[model samples]
Target: MSDNSQSAAALVQRYYDAFNAGDVPGMLACLSEDVAHDVNQGGRRTGKALFGEFCAHMERCYREQLTDIVVMPSADGRRAAAEFTVNGTYLSDDDGLPPATGQTYCLPAGTFFDIADGKITRVTTHYNLQDWIAQVTGTGA
Candidate 1:
């Protein structure tokens, strides 16, 4: 990989590190002011304020950590992708998901990022919602 690509990978790695540490401010620091977030199986939200709101809501509903992370950056350093495992516990009821009862779950998830000027401009996350629902509901294999 090129130097720029390595830098992109480092930026993504730092983002995940901040996420694992539950450092919302650190995570936001890696993002551009006008960051765009594409939530898993959900609509897109733009800007740091909205992103912070989303993070707040997530904090209220769940406690999570990412592990087994692997980041891959594009050659030009403009894009990157990461795969990781999410270990989490449902803490409270979310808007449309199942009710929470402190149920713990492990799920594989991935994210794509768009980077520019050393800041993440866009973040898109993906995971299997149905699988998560089943696991939390005691109905999955």
Candidate 2:
């Protein structure tokens, strides 16, 4: 484990910490200016500004926290991966999803990151949409 790997791991840890604390500024501080985000079960969105917009939208529609987070960095410090459980409540209606009734769900999720110059350049998140929908809608889907 090189020093750089440790730094990368720390950066990722801080990012999650910021997320848990609902500090959007702190989370953005960990990302590069042109950071790219591959949203869970969705398309790619780039740049910190766009990321902030995405965050705002998420904030409007859902209240979420990540639990049991584990971050693993590559030996070279250019890549990392994280696994966690998303504890969330659907707060408002979102397009292409079941209506929100303040439903609570716990979903397992993962994310991969690309780091450079002590900042995250890319983030790709993964999770099961159907499972989440089923849980939220109570349809056992």
Root-mean-square deviation per candidate? 0.7, 0.7
lDDT string for model 1 (19-90, tens) is: 999899999999999999999999999999999999999999999999999999999999999999999999
- lDDT comparing candidate 2 with the true structure: 0.96
Residue 93 shift from truth in candidate 1, angstroms: 0.4
The pairs that clash in candidate 1 are none
The clash number for model 2 is: 0
After the best TM-score superposition of candidate 2, give how far the Cα of residue 97 lies from its true spot, in angstroms: 0.7
lDDT of 2 by residue, 53-120 (tens): 99999999999999999999999999999999999999999999989999999999999999999999
lDDT of each: 0.96, 0.96
**Predicted candidate 2: what Cα RMSD to the true structure?**
0.7
| Consecutive 10-residue window with the lowest summed lDDT within model 2 | 132-141
In model 1, the Cα lDDT at residue 76 comes to 96
